[model samples]
Target: MFWSAEADTSAVLLAQMPVVLPAAANLYSALREPAAREDEDGTHFLFEAGGQTIRIARLAGVPPEIPLAAFVPLDADGFDRMEGIGRLLRALQGRTIPDDHRLTPQQKRRHRHMLQATDGRMNGATYRDIAGVIFGVDRVASEHWKTSALRDATTALVKDGLAMIAGGYRMLLRHRRRS
Candidate 1:
């Protein structure tokens, strides 16, 4: 694919992005079945918890950048309350993520970079402190350019087994304990 000169690259630029949104909120995926949790109805309950904007669209193969777009100007909490879109988004939240899972070399490096940049702490950082370096921005970023990071990060984490629906089924990241 070729880059568009007039395109809003900053809106989709991952490196220059911020981390403050749910790292795992994304496009349509099957809602989680209750197993590890008690009587969890995943999506249905997630939207009700209410705090983000959510929506759905068809895709043969959506670029990682597209979902990141959702984060900007419309974080999950914005859509989480919408009548039509919220249902679709809530249904698409990913299930549990594992702790021991490894990240892609690039992602691993990014995580390291974040740790270093923040000096391994998030005193003033929003998502960074709360979600750690990787998830901190991913959970709270609803700006245009950062949306893809939110989408891709969440999807990657879930696929690699690093996140989960908390007891309340709000998108909760697999938090790392500080040493």
Candidate 2:
């Protein structure tokens, strides 16, 4: 699900952390079906555990076999980096990861609707037609097409979905801050 290295801020950076030889605790044994790749930046590992994907990165010069003590930077993204390290720690310790980080049911439903509406529009469906599918057909029929709130809602959903598809969805990973 994390398609881009720049967008996915959840990676636990091993190179930045303290390296321990003959590690007392290691991530290699605890992760499930870990997939690894090497690039100019580092060695990257992706795995699924505790109902979420865990991403780990080691910088180019770091040894791949060593265990790293989690190190978090005190910056704008400190909280997110801390959270990622916390999840990695829990996984390494054979402890259950908490599910409190997931999105709410309402947010999920709205995102679903946004994608559906965007799909309909891309396939040449009118906003009214999309509204009929999302809202009940009878409800769409009851309102005047020229001055319907559903029309505006359907339009907004498509616009929002398009923005997400255009890479704005990356914002979903970080905590919101007042600007």
Candidate 3:
């Protein structure tokens, strides 16, 4: 149902937005049943047919700032050789797709910690108090706690947790490419 003069642009836009064409959804449903790989960038949906390798990458971009569903072709030659490019394109147009916002286990854990820390702060706990609760009172009371590794680590964790809550958590969600 989607129409585009340019294939690459269409692919990128479809991947970036939550709009789903039945075609694209069906394509993803059919494709993701195979084993996928995870890396620093994102999850890669790969398969082979017609003697060519095809790869569809769901890239995780910085959250809040970027859309979570951005998908792209990893293999240019293979993509060009893909048998159903036209069908995929039509599927990417017109309709809306459900958002896949499930967070990873690590992200879920971090989110909980972040929420707890933020709640503590909102309830009148100081940075030192927060550190005490998180790193142990003995460590917080140490002479070097304020200027040492524990303090730095606590600060970093708080900042990262806050950022994730603010928006970064969106990146943790899997895009709507169902297996």
TM per prediction? 0.17, 0.83, 0.37
Candidate lDDT values, in order: 0.32, 0.74, 0.49
Which of 1 and 2 is the better model by TM-score? 2
Candidates sorted on lDDT, descending: 2, 3, 1
Number of the top TM-score candidate: 2
The number of clashing residue pairs in each candidate reads: 42, 0, 5
Writing each residue's lDDT as its tens digit, candidate 1 over 35-123 gives 21112211111222133322222222333253332322354333222323333433345332222222356756655544443433324
Off by over 4 Å in 1: 1-18, 25-62, 65-81, 93-179
The TM-score measured for candidate 3 stands at: 0.37
**Between candidates 2 and 3, the lDDT winner:** 2
Off by over 4 Å in 3: 1-111, 174-179
Q: Per-residue lDDT tens digits of candidate 2, residues 89-175?
A: 887776898764545778779889999999999999999999999998999999998899999999999999999899877777765
lDDT by residue (69-128, candidate 3, tens digit) is: 434446532333232344343344423333223456775676676776777777887767
Worst 10 residues of 2 by lDDT: 16-25
